[model samples]
Target: MRLWLGLPVASALPRAHLCVFIPISERSRKDGALSLAALGTWAQEQLQRDAGAKVRFVSVGSTAGSPLEPYTLHVPGDEEVGYKRLPVRILKIWHYLGQEDDCDWVMKADSDTYVNLRGVSDRLSCFDPEEEHFFGVVHAIVPPRQLREMWPALYFGHGGSGYVVSRGLLPKVGRSALPCLEDMLEMTQGDAMEDVIFALCLQRRLDVQVESYGFLRPGGAWDAQLAEQEFVVNFHQARDELLDRRPKAPLQRWLHWDAQPPPLHACVMVAHPVENETDMMEVHRKLRADAAAQVLALAPTASEWAEPERMPLGLGRAQCVPSPMALARQAEVRLSAAGAPVKAFWTPKQLEQLSQCLVHSLGKKRCGWTDIREQRYGLSYWPPAQSSDACAEACCRSGADCSLFQYRADEGCWLGRWEESQAVASDKVWQGAVKVW
Candidate 1:
């Protein structure tokens, strides 16, 4: 991971690369002196101690610092509004690539962000860096009232959260898109936000595909339980205080394949003979109601058997046999040969484990509603319900597809699809009930 820091600065640089990047006016240099000293010290420590991949910290600004002259790259721009800074910095990186093009990805971030570099490298390995790709926790931005007419749809990654651009796409952006971008910046009188400008250039102008990932951001509310998982990558708006507070874990801790438990892939071999399609449907419904059973295909007749030649059990067409016992025996043999753990009889404990595994593998925990209410979107209406409990029961009985229900005191229940139910601010009379896994 050849990581380079394209930090924009106005006044003094921090000792650590992680220090906050707050551009200061020329008059405030005295106030920034101490922070600059701290930054120099931190830079020395990083140079001495960090034995992994070498990270090049290049500070970008209008003028080079007296002390940090070696690390600073002087780009022509006003220090106050560095609108052209990013594209220029990126172009400079591309120029550096002309000399040494070994870097797989380029990360553009503010100094206040705490980046798990190993986590980023691991995530990038999943995609082809040779292709035009962009990654970030994407945010849909509504333009300011004054700029709304000129810029209608402004979708960008929150810069505080940070974003990554592939090396292959950077050169193209610099060559083809930068001129248009600079014009936009001039038009906005430097008011266009840097992240938004980058987003517009990549998506609207150059047509680069931006993929969103769930990397944590500062002040963004996330499931506290899930945030503890290894998948979370960065923390935005981090302060210097974190250096002493957080533990020094191995960088490899952040690098792991995001492997979820495999889905419960098993076939329910019906041992009892079925008369018709209705009988088969009823049997399928009953088995599916158990939750543990993900019955992919069914053998409803004695003439139908799960073929061992199919090996993995459910993928191929079902085979016919003389008896129901033959079908069960065939299913057991085939599933066992395919390396799946086979049991002669499924105990309640085993079934429960299977159900739990299915839930974990799917990764979406069902949402529950108690006193909450939503407006205007209902899939279907049911008969008059006396209470919320009755409405909930109705939703449950409506099969697994039913996601929610809204019930009025004297009226019936409204069955709703999960996507349609958007919560409204006003609380009228209706009570809502949502299915929880």
Candidate 2:
């Protein structure tokens, strides 16, 4: 059976290939030991048990303490004032770890962040350790003139989000970039972010290849909606309470690629006939061409798409209907027959009702469960309610495959294909709609 959409089944990497390092302080050792360190150990054990993937996790701290005695690697630095010396400490750890152990990739993470090692292994499988590759959630620095004197341009991964460096780039960075950074730190009196400094070393000095990945959760208030994401690799700034309650939230099922089977293409029936024959002809031509190209690129036959099991959650074959109302009705039929998730185009009137229901539910501090058939439904977005109702309607009308609508104050409206299983309590500003058929 297929695991996650688009991603193929990946083979496990050898235990010696991957290493994860977490930077902790002496003061926060207890909390770190109970939270991040415990989670990392659990993740490693789980992956080893489930997928036969071996991963090493280590804690890097400056001070010697009982809490860190088991797996801690004591580097030469002052633990109390380590923030200013973070870049130096990181370099020292890299060099020291390189000498002590043989690893293909070295990942640096914060004490509060939770990592999904299986996802990390899967992502690393795509690149070679010999290549000078840097992987992380990339962020560009925009200026209002604070440190223009030290560096001209700056781009770096948010360190709380974590980053990975290949074995090939380590020596180059140590040889060339570390000395320059040391001189710069001495001249500037050490007030730079470690992530920015590292990125400058990789991108500006060595000109290594940087690959951005979206596995890191954005920094914001906690949203339970994120638990539904199929490919989330890490969560930063997670609350201690949440982690205590749901420790397994960071690791989802691993996605594996399955062999191609017979294609089952859905027939599109244009319920609403267009006025101009030429316009209809052009539409048909474009659709046919696009479908043919997709089949040629990924499938063995024109009639076959990836099996429904392999498709992304809340996605299925497309169907054309006469109007938003007709589409909703058709969706009801599909939802009732197969009891599968279905998407429907919504009219402005229907969208307005959804928005009002969401607002009302939010105000009442209750889940926004709209009545669809005999059951209640809610919106399904990661950040939840990304846009306005008007924007959502426009998206539904513009695209041939939009099914759900959500609107939030200041954020505007968003269109999505999948429906959320349940409405978790969210910000009061968010609103959503589900098909009521």
- Candidate 2 yields a Cα-based lDDT of 0.42
Q: How many residue pairs clash in model 1?
A: 4
**Colliding pairs, model 1:** 14-39, 15-38, 15-39, 15-40
lDDT for each residue of candidate 1 in 1-437, tens digit (9 for 90 to 100): 33233434333332221211222233434313522432333223342233121233344333354554434433233233353454444434433432323346665544333233333443344355677766664555665667666766544555645566665675676565446546665776445566776677676667764544322222222323222222222321111111122345422222221211111112221111222233223333332232222222343342323332222222111111111111111122211111212322222322223223333333223345555565546345544335677556545543454667777776556665577656666546667766764
Runs of candidate 1 exceeding 4 Å displacement: 1-54, 60-100, 144-150, 216-224, 228-437
lDDT of 1: 0.40
Which candidate wins on lDDT?
A: 2
Model 2 ranges with Cα > 4 A deviation: 1-15, 29-31, 34-41, 44-68, 76-80, 98-101, 145-153, 215-437
What is candidate 2's lDDT per residue for 264-380, written digit by digit as tens?
Answer: 111221101121233223323333443344544555563454442222111111211122322332222211112212312232333343333333322222122242222123422
Error of 1 at 178 (Å): 2.9
Looking at candidate 2, what is the lDDT of residue 420?
Answer: 35
Clash number for candidate 2: 10
